[model samples]
Target: MHKRGQSFLGEVRDQIRSKEAKDFVSAELNHHLKAAKNKWIEKGMDETEAEEKAVVQMGSPITLGQKLNKLHRPKVDWLTVMLLVTTLGLGFLPILFMDADYYLQYNMDASSFSVQKVVFSLLGAVLAFCVMLVNYRRLESFGWLFYSIGVLILVLLQNSFDMINGVSILVIGPFTINSLSVMPFFLLAWASFFNHKKLKLWHLSLLFVCSFWLFVNTVNLPAIYIYTFMVFGLFLCSRFSRKIKWMITGGIMGSLLLLGFIVWPSLEMYQLVRLLAFVNPEQYAEGEGYMMLLLQDHISKAGWFGNALNSGTIPNVHTDFVFVGFTYYFGWLAACALFIVLALFIVRIIMIARNIHEPFGKLLLNGAVALYTVQLVSNVGMTFGLVPITTISLPFISYGLIPIVLNAFIVGVVLSVYRRKDLTSMRTFQPQQ
Candidate 1:
């Protein structure tokens, strides 16, 4: 009966709630039923009998629909959710105690900055979730737009803005946005789409030139290094040839060395002193190396449990040197726990990146993971005098608005990739008969 064919598809549609699942099942069933009907027709059956036979041979529509529904369901990554909760719990705990009136001994002023920090943190969290809901493929269309905006910001900051203590901050009315923190996100997004059939020299040159100008203008060495590493990771993960990979690697290395050469001479005496202090902190303990010396002193005093937040008089202890202050306050065991959680998060991201189905998504995630890894190492290393203090914020634990929001957005994009790891896409469509 012709009605049998209609009944079969309708039964499948009734079993599956999502249109995507229903369409997919209907297409597969139609394809199979057409073949079965042809087989029956060639075997001497009439069209109506053939249609009825095809419906029977295609198996139970309810069972097939149930299986397809299970396959197409959106999967939530519970592990990532739990890890993020642990990270946020540990990260916000310090600010809670530091800013609370009951804990302040010297009548600390309760400024609006603290309230804004919490507000931005919540906003960042919401932004990340919103980004996850968006289709990542759609973001590819805006790659150049994002890149141009970043480059434009750097250009404006270099030429039009007045310098604040020798560093440029883009001031828009009431808010001063840090160009260093924002530029890398755009650059990394640009890098994600660089994979091509043939690796063009001009494309590579464009990337180098933009990165070079950003580095020259901002003079934020740590951010530049992270951005550079991200570019490297992006290229390495791309589908380029081995020769091209080597060439890109060499070009990046050469460019970094040349940039350092050009930027080094322009550095102030104190900046040069800070670079030297990384080699030997004690030799310059009273001068530019004082931060490193003080950081070491604070870390040394913090036993396994910490000095209960009695971090010595290190300037900007709550910002640049917060990790040391944290270890000194919470103890080394808590620091180790923090380290374990961070390590697991990075590892989880890497695992997800590797498993991602799309090349662009994979490359994008590689850049993000590389940026986070570099920032983590740089910040933690600075806390113990292992690396030069470059004023880089610790990824999730830092006390800053831009870093928190940007990091949340990055994590959200990664989660978007993870959530849709199985299906390359889902599109609304009508089922064909």
Candidate 2:
């Protein structure tokens, strides 16, 4: 290459702060210079003269670099930020104003719970900001590593688990992390796998099989549902051929059917009853259907302005049953407003994903969308008795430290992706001699 073009690219690179952006800008400029030089040479100009002409045609390197720097600078989606703040505020309100008596059974008081909520909320915010500062593309290379780590965590939890209220938890010092907290890591890992250039159908099948095995060992139905949806969503968004996609889809469906057939009869009576309770809560109202019936009653009695019912009949009122408890206190009008906020937040994320040109970033965003959608639908559906009751908590609204922190990490990843959405260019340019 000519010294003039090399010097021009160097000057442009000096203006771009992001290393990734600089590489993209240099490649693009090099491609343009080569193309222009070729055109000049085609007109019978000497090769040296052609290179000089190409460099001159590029104009001032400083000015072009400045323009490119401005164009490729990292950006923040303020609307998403505002929506997150609003949701967190709404989540805090219920815990803040709940009757002090509710915490008594847990050997705590309302003030302490509020304090914990504030502390955890701040921690989550900091964690998210830290994640946002990172370049998400770098994570694409660690797909299998993350997957292995996630699997290891689950394995450890399985072998040394502590049962708290029928839920599996891992006790680390004073902290108790739920087994399902590993789902987000798996989500990222799967996204990386899907974005791999050498991805294959058998690789995905093995992943699914492994995930199913872990979920079965943990007996976490909600995690299984979320993982399945995420896998399917990522597969659809993958760059695989349509034929391979269909083949994998059919295989997954058939495997699920077969697994269900084999597992259904082996479920204990209580487990089977719990699975079928949502279909007819009235039938099992005294046992597995009791919570569903209670939730329905509370929701039905919640008028437009709410009944301000703080009777605390709903179990885990601040966690799994938060929405129901919130409705009983704040009424349907407030609930609808919360729903709208959540809907808009999700829609904003989808919009961000839509504008992303990078395939891996888009896959990560879509995977997040899939996970959030399932959780939102399932949690809300179970509250109204439309789906089976599980321990799934509403995202951002539930009062749990592990969940809030994990969700914040996801939000941070999304922010990181949006930050670089405009800086990456997928076009390949051959080197110019």
Candidate 3:
């Protein structure tokens, strides 16, 4: 080739070598060649001659060495997965082996109390695992739609009058759906996840008002409070400390004002009893304080080793006061171990949230952590008389199917965050494992 032709080949080769050169080559190459080729054609070179001219004009293919570089992929944290699965197994197996009859005397044969509850709990985990395999970012666009559907289902369930043995499956089914409770969690989290929660005051105001509306309509303070804490946590994660302070002040004042004016319950009845019982156990002792008395007395009998499963005189040891079972049958060390696992669960969620660079994935993980922490603190606190009982459970430790299933699904969302890649930002990453 001529010296100029050699220079042309070198330029083409160098452009192909550097991947970054792709944009420059893509934009300019065809135009540069077509013009050069037309000139050759107009001068009476044939089509094949013009094509040769165009190829030579762009430079030679031999110099394209950059194509040898391979694209990089993100690293997976398999250790995290292994540790999580092991913990879940430990947490779940106790409930499976303990036997349902050990839980409640009255409803021992009921479907809610039957062995099938375990299936629902595991199913929730299964569903969550499948969902985690989906890329999480893709949900932002459809968040509102998913949220609305969750709300609509509760609304429809509320209108039912049918009952099994006087217990309505609609309002408090084998599950519970206080429109006021679950919907706020679904919607507020969705709203907060998008846009780094760049919500205007009106947007926040709207969520509160909608929550209050649903609360009054349904009368579910425990669920509403759970929802409130979750939303507030999401907002805190999204905003600055100063804004959080202002929001909290406004929220407290607004909550008290609403409590005063509305006929709605502020301290949900069960929680109110736990509060009053803790304060004046004598005045409320016979009627409302009975369970607390039983729980405290049973825990007193528990020593270093603790009595065996059926040895304790505790009633309802498997359900509401299960932590007492941990303390009583398994001893204080087991109770301490319960908290340790709970701590591990929350810390794992925080680590996942911190590692994620994207806003939505972080919010998803934050929501899961906040939700679990709220329930964990209240349930165990009430058991020990530190906080009022609000009918909350110990997350995965509690065997309630409906709520546990929902929590399991949330875990799947956390798994989605870990599966994402660095070079390719997929919307949701669903992992098979």
lDDT digits (tens) for residues 1-433 of candidate 3: 3344345445554545333333334334445555666778899997667767666544435433242112212234564455445544545544533554554555465455445655755676577667666666667777656656655654564455344422113544355543423532474345443344466656765856664555444444566677777776776665446776687769878988987667346668876676678876667768777767777787788776666655555555555667777777777887787688767778878877777767777777787787778877887887777776555666666665655665666666667667663323322322111
lDDT tens per residue, model 1, 201-316 = 67766866775677667766666677767676676777777898898679768987999999998999887887788898788988877777777887888889776634345455
Between which residue pairs do clashes occur in model 1?
304-332, 305-331, 306-331, 309-329
**Candidate numbers sorted by lDDT from highest down:** 2, 1, 3
The Cα error of candidate 3 at residue 89, in Å, is 3.2
Candidate with best lDDT: 2
Report, for every candidate in turn, its global Cα lDDT versus the true structure.
0.70, 0.81, 0.60
Write out the backbone clash pairs for model 2: none
Q: Candidates 1 and 2: which is better by lDDT?
A: 2
In model 3, which regions exceed 4 Å deviation?
1-84, 91-104, 109-114, 160-199, 239-241, 244-275, 421-433
Per-model TM against the reference? 0.81, 0.90, 0.70
Could you give the candidate ranking by TM-score, starting with the highest? 2, 1, 3
Error of 3 at 99 (Å): 7.5
Better of 2 and 3 by lDDT: 2
Best by TM-score: 2
Query: Model 1: runs farther than 4 Å from truth?
Result: 1-61, 96-108, 111-113, 160-162, 181-188, 196-201, 254-271, 309-311, 424-433
